[model samples]
Target: MIHFTPKFYLIGRVTHTGTQRDGTPFSQVWKTIDSLGSGTYGDVVLQELQGSPGGGCLHAVKSITKKAHKNNKKILTNELKALIAVKKHPTKVVTFHGWYQDSQQTMFIAMEYVSGGSLERYMRKLKRVENILISSTSPLLVKICDFGIAKSADIDASGLKT
Candidate 1:
């Protein structure tokens, strides 16, 4: 039987693009740069994707400690399903690379790291500017994402049910 894994994300992510000469997957090493935000459920961090500097790869890794809540796993599973549902529209939604569970059972969701600064920060800058407008050629679209209760019982790290 084929195995199906589940992926979870609330933003964009990076995936392994190639294998090594020995036919083994090249291991990825993620280094945390800073903390973006945190909440009752988990914390988001700015991570630098090492060994691929030229790719301009950076990811926001959201880590939810197993002790965060009693149903943390279930909530994350639902989030994963919602992420998968929007995978086709990556420009509007965050791309999900994948997730990992450490030995401590802390779930880490890998996503794209937006570097233009937070919306709030951008707004403040706009207020100070004499004239700020969206270019007709490139309109800015601010979206509020909402994913209702969703969960996938059969999902994991090895593979996801696309």
Candidate 2:
């Protein structure tokens, strides 16, 4: 239950704004909606821009305490910088939409929310259903995603952020 206090910075956002459908950002948040997934740090949610009347879109809002981020700053910084340097590729990793922070011990990173969930989970579901065809999609997508990650890294290294 990630509750964004009203005091949190509110920003206006637009969707499918430019090339590659890069979301529009008139302000920090493009839109606001009910969150869909949960993790220890934060939750993913679909949000709509304020006063846009355009509704909301899928976004993963990672909420982390300042302590947690500071503890993992080295890795996090690498990941963030790498992510920022990379171009948008659906086959690789998820896209970094935007981020927000407050005086409180909380920081939020808004990223593209892949609706299909994780590849590992998708694989498990395929096994349970015993569907060979569906099973293939997971690997294929994961590979594409891997390429995306690799593209973000230096040629010789495993890239930043394990």
Candidate 3:
């Protein structure tokens, strides 16, 4: 049978790609560099794909749980769809690259790494004109990263998944 093992992000030892997580197959992964922040569910790790198509570019790894409310299929579908929609935008939001799962059903979101500063940091550096006034010329541009509990959009929207 084609065993579709579930995977979620975790906070522990992750073997390099090619090894199986709990039984699911993950080829290999390099060490994490930065912390991209965490949510109620899981955390994010920053790393680089060694010798990838473009010779080792950076990537963001979102480690979430398969045991979460929506399950893997739902989460994957939503993220894939969102990525398709936002890929063309020239913003600071991370670009969706791909996904992986482990035998125990842990999922990880792989996306393009952003070299620019984060939204929080950008906002902090902005100068407040007054207590009631907010600066309109602040460099911190915010982009909404929207994902719902359900698969909000259709898969294959960008035709990249096929």
Candidate 1 runs further than 4 Å off:
1-24, 53-56, 122-138, 143-162
Tell me how many clashing residue pairs each candidate has: 11, 12, 17
The candidate that wins on TM-score is: 1
Q: Candidate 1 vs candidate 3: which has greater lDDT? A: 1
lDDT of each: 0.54, 0.45, 0.52
TM-score list, all predictions: 0.61, 0.52, 0.56
Q: Which TM-score value belongs to model 2? A: 0.52
| True-structure RMSD for candidate 3 | 8.8
Sliding window of 10 residues with minimal summed lDDT for model 1: 128-137
lDDT of 2: 0.45
